[model samples]
Target: MISAPMLDHIVYAVPDLERGVNDIERQVRVRPVSGGTHAGGLTHNALLSLGAGSYLEIIAPVPGSEAPTGALPFGLETLTEPRLVTWAVAVDDIERRIEAARLAGYDPGERMAGGRDLPDGSRLTWQLAVRAEPAGDGIVPFLIHWLSEPHPSGTAPEGCQFVALRAEHPKPESVLRVLRALAVELDVNEGAAPRLIATLETPSGRVELS
Candidate 1:
């Protein structure tokens, strides 16, 4: 089980934004709040609180938006259904963390700034580190440093508690090695494919989302 203190937020990607929100609400019994649109108009998102400091991000294509200028983040364009695509970990000095990971044989790419407009006319800004290739196919977490105050979790819809996180990968050892380099720990099991499994305590009772 991964520690909650080190966990930031988990990403749930879908092909249709509103449909995904409804499906997740039906399962968890908690409606998500609008988190607002991203830069490029390629995607938009809604947020659900996963207890203090952490949340679940439901991301998808912005309806009627222009064609993507390039490949979308997290492969949202081709997802067949809603899936636990990846996750992020809050960190300080993200650039330093990226350098440290590279020294340990894993490169988390470079620090990049990102922001989205909030519903209240304010903007939420942050910097993140992501690899050109998905880090361990999205099992290993990326790094994020929030530049804004009073994190999104504080204002998101509540009632879900993040319980545990783990993964299944055909090559567990390789994934573990990268996690070690980043100083993060996770329960991983050998399996046929790479998948992230998150256990949560929702109003609907205990549930697993992957």
Candidate 2:
């Protein structure tokens, strides 16, 4: 059996990266840490530090975009508005994990290297596997492999820590089962309604559901 790994990051898809980051900062009261661009010029990402090698990621496409090189994969093509698209979990070996996913009946595609530019102009690169289908209401996490040296979140900004993460659905246990089947490691449970909730600790106070 495949064992789930640590919670890596959660992704939110927005129409615009700059605007999305600003909006989230306004709500959370902290500027999200920057993550660099992706391969297809789909610029993105702000990192919310969650203690213990985990974090929340908010992603958006760059404005005035060019057409992406390949066919749009699962969540990217279907997303109509800014919302939580998918979460990612870390693995010791991305290649091995991809094989495991394939054996378990998920056709995770080839590994792709992508990058994002930081606000300060520095760039960071990472790897990911795009799935053929949306993982059912964004509850299922896509796989990610961080290729950059030392991993992103190694030196997280001060005043941030991941407290707990929760996912809510009418069939909460079912959702957990899917996540488990995908080998994602986290403690997930039902919420008040059919929604996913993530809790964070910041300098200001505790924040929930980003």
How displaced is residue 10 in candidate 1, in Å? 0.1
Please provide, for model 1 over 90-190, each residue's C-alpha lDDT reduced to its tens digit, 9 standing for 90 to 100: 99899889988989988888899999988788888999998767867899999999999779889999999999999999999999999999888999899
Best by TM-score: 1
Kindly report which residue pairs in candidate 2 clash with one another: 36-115, 36-116, 36-117, 37-115, 37-116, 37-117, 50-162, 51-162
Query: What are the C-alpha RMSDs, in order, of all predicted structures?
Result: 1.1, 4.0
- Tell me how candidate 2 scores on lDDT: 0.64
Residue lDDT tens for model 2, 8-99: 77677776667777876776677777676664565556676666777667776555554456333324544566676667776667788888
Number of backbone clashes in candidate 1: 0
